[model samples]
Target: MAVNVFASATEAGDTAVPLGGSGVAATVDCPDLSERLTTVPEQARPDVDTELARLDEQIAAAYRQLQEAARTADDAKLDEGAILDPLKKERAGTIERIAAVIGKAGKRPEGLDTLAECTLRRTEVATTDAPGGSPDQQRQQQNGKGEEPGNTGNTGNTGDDGDDGQTGDGQQPGNGGQAGNGPVAADYADINSVRPNVVQAPRQKNASTGSFATSCGVNAEGLFNSDNLIAAPGVSNGAHHFHDYVGNQANDAFSSDEDLAAAGTSCADQGDKSSYYWPVLRLQNGTVEQDAESPGGGIEGNAGEIVTPAEVTLRFEGNERGEVTEMPRLLRIITGDAKAFVNGDTNANASWSCTGFEDRQLKDKYPLCPSGSDVVRTFTFQSCWDGRNIDSANHRTHVAFAAADGTCPDGFRAIPRLVQRVVYDVDAPSLQDGGRTVPLFAVDSFPEQLHKPVTDHSDFINVFDEDLMREMADCINSGRECGPDTPPGSEPGQGENPQEQPTENPTKDPQEQPTENPDASDPPAERTATASAPAVPGQDGRDDGESEGKGGGSGAGRNDGQASAPPAQERDDDASPRAEPRAATTPADDTPDDASGAAPAPGATQGTGGGEDAAAGSATEPQATRGGLAETGSGLGLWPAAAGGVLFAGGCVLLIRSRRRSM
Candidate 1:
């Protein structure tokens, strides 16, 4: 996203869309409900009430600091909006956290009225004294939108206009709970109670069971990003962070229509090349620079992209009854909201658990895997299709989940559900790597994430041809265990030796069909086999799509027949577990091993910002202090100029609009 110098300076009218719409941050604030709390006498509140009250004060304080920061930026008139961008984002997050806790403090008394959600009134300073600029040369002006959180009922905003903060009840009831934002801000009880309303009702179903799955390419060495999926519309590999892909060798952001036309695949079925990707989870050592933390760790700058996982397994879980009529040929999904880290619980669609740790299944915070257990990060995406539109306005409305009995809801049709399990073999700690213990905080898994910590999310784009997609749907509704070689729980030919990695090649179907390279090494035509079919609608905003409201943008990676049993779920592992083979994960090398490793994962390449450094992949490269951002030549540093232009413009418009109304 570059600065539109020409448009800002020469245009006769303000753009209907903000100039920096694609550039800087969002405002996530909700109307303040302080006065609403007056109804419940402080004395009658729960022990958590005092904490909520205190957080409110902090929210107010942060708002003030943000105001002060805006003033400082306005005074200097920095060219790039980068420096102040982060400060503003962080402050906004702090405010939202307070709001989530307040909202979760439970509803206020029936009539307790709170202060209308506090609005971060915009402020502007003249292009007064910008550095290195003469009076006439000062082109940059700073505009402040304050903090707005995403919409969450009546809650406050994060960096943009916040969502209504009301719970399923859509109201704070009566000072019954806190009244701010995010699930993280509230406790376990609240998180469960506020399961985001699945706007699309589950479609009804009669039978369950028919579905096919691809084998996981346990060989971490095979990971790479190549454009072979939904092309034309969405930018390929646009995720700012690196991604780890599993299915479909030739699938990525830049895939062309022809490429998707070819029926090549990485699934056990020869033609089921659906693409799946999520951010690469890196190890953060409190020790070195990159490994230590985002603004802190890593050797040269940060740490080299650490080693690939020891193993990966991909299998489809089917409904119990029988198969149905058909499945959506090409379905796409992105699991979780973008701001989970900052807002907490806002879209708590994440599940953290250990192989042998079922008792602590849905704990809010990631729990430690027992000594020999693997740290599993499981993400689920909604699969019920409206049967009419392949994609909905919000990327979710058209899709809903099937009931436990495997039936779709009233207006919805059941599609095969997609569940991804990202496993890390970190139980046997390696001091050589970053000092990260397994089961670390996910979401913003990076210790100091660009936005908020534990802000974990994932993206997908289906490039399957119509015929193959139809076949896949048939496989699902028909209850056929699609993969001929590897089915769920049955690792073909490896008879119960649970420890040894599967020797099965994921690049081939059960028939041993050769696959095109995922590293772009193969010739374009051959590698990106294409077909002439309708393109699948893009997923959530990891790339450029549309609005996230209504039925568009991605919704939370969704519901299982029912929410997983909460953390207290009862289950015991083997009294004493047996040792499993430890995967020899590659360690971060100080030297650049350009020749090693797979192609950089999606978005971690050049052009997208220098993100695809050999060091970032190749199992060894310069440790990047800034991770993907610095690699891409993108940092907050570039935004000041752009931010100045947009904010200045927004302020002017608001002021003009206000004056006109008054007249």
Candidate 2:
């Protein structure tokens, strides 16, 4: 099972073709054409969007050809004539069509032909345990102390070497089933060996200190898709990877803004129709999933069984410097780069760690958790909104991350930051055997990405009703800690709060307990909301029951009318509930844990700004705020956690590009 680990970044990036364990493998890397556009004519937007999607498909087809050529022919050359030239030709035509559409309604874009030509790239992974590298050299490159040739912006360390011996299974060590693509031995690190690099930003006097937690059930209903409406509208199989979706159910490639608004939701609070999605993680154990033979699955190099999450937590945190404003309905956001392996880490935002070691976050590597500890993935989305568009030409320029000092860039408003945490309970894989005994798990990715840990990402869309959105903004601006089950001004453990402490089961919130006398077929009453929020009508005037769009709940009670019985669905064989063990207490020597379980009060004493109270000006209300030029936004992940103060540094700018070859 032993396979060749990349010796150095130089070896991998020296030429267009890099030698994998199986032979030469190449990927298509092209400039993001959409980012060059200053504006898209409103009438031509749809046609232009479709043409842009065509460009992606052209690249995908070329990459697929390269993979097939590598698998069958030894030392096959990725000749420009056979792959790149044809791809370029296809792209040039698509680019012209895009220009034609835009020219009819507005000024024609120039220099689009320059973006047609593509380059071949190989996965650039550096290894300390390999034959030609030293631990000190690897450590320096990982700590940003030094940069390897052609490996700029690669600040991830693979940690110290672990047990690397051949396993009895026939799988190759470096390749997790996909021949040249990865989940390689060098892509994982031991959590304890990594230094703690997390820094907390001090809250200023005018900061919004309130917190709001939402009870969106783990995707137990097995909702899975390969469509990305935001990135590639109207294009089926747009995202060449399977995504696990929560919140909204009717989110596919063709879903219109109105369709999503009227669709059903998976959240316990039905009023929140917002959609959240991320790539699904799969165990590379040779188990064939239902999607194994379909697009975005085995046909696209994504094999193995899909692993569902044990718990999911969706919490909204306030800005560190000032009061927050309500997010516009249909406002779209993407948190991490999905093609970071080849694109570089300028936009990479992945945070992988073990449940017990929450303090150590890995941006480019997956954590090989210790036994009894579960794997955790955290996504802290951008919290700032530009005063203008809900979506820009590149889908990112409309939103930006705050400055290091906790203030939004001028003209941008601070919005509630969504921190999604997902947890999975899987046994540590035998990397030596290439995950033969206990299967190795990797997140779903585009075929060319090769399942690199750095390419992990998530997507979101805001669909909250006006009143609820107002409540969330008020709670955060006022510095009150609230949950979906908590009233407007009340904090957890006050008023009708059901549970005071963390629950043992991560999937079932203690606050989501069912009513005592429940009907056999009726859904749970007060599933997640307090008396202040009311259930909204779903499509066809039907109310969303607990089992309406989900697989299993405890037949929970809700204060609602009975709808038709849930439609029958094929059981997801890969989804088996696993025990979620309690995480070990944070070591006392670490940074002071805020015992109040609430952010510092908004008007409290200054932090590093170090001053007395001052006049807090009115909050900046962006055009993306409620009731502006309304457009559309689209969907998408998490597993769960204990009830405690999880202070994520929200000051870091997280401007991520969409998956439409948007660099």
Q: Return the top candidate by lDDT.
A: 2
Count clashing residue pairs in model 1.
148
Candidate 1 lDDT score relative to the true structure: 0.32
Best by TM-score: 2
Off by over 4 Å in 1: 1-206, 222-237, 263-265, 286-304, 319-323, 343-346, 403-407, 428-454, 463-480, 486-663
Please give the CA lDDT of all the candidate structures: 0.32, 0.55
Question: Cα RMSD (Å) per model?
Answer: 30.3, 21.5
Each candidate's TM vs. the true structure? Answer: 0.41, 0.67
Model 2 lDDT, residue 74, Cα: 48
lDDT of 1 by residue, 108-183 (tens): 3332123223222121111112111110111121133221122122221111122222223443211211011111
Per candidate, the number of residue pairs that clash is 148, 17
lDDT of 2 by residue, 510-626 (tens): 223211221212211111110001111110000011111121212222111211211122111232221111110111112222311111111111101100010010011111112
Tell how far residue 387 is off in model 1, in angstroms: 1.0
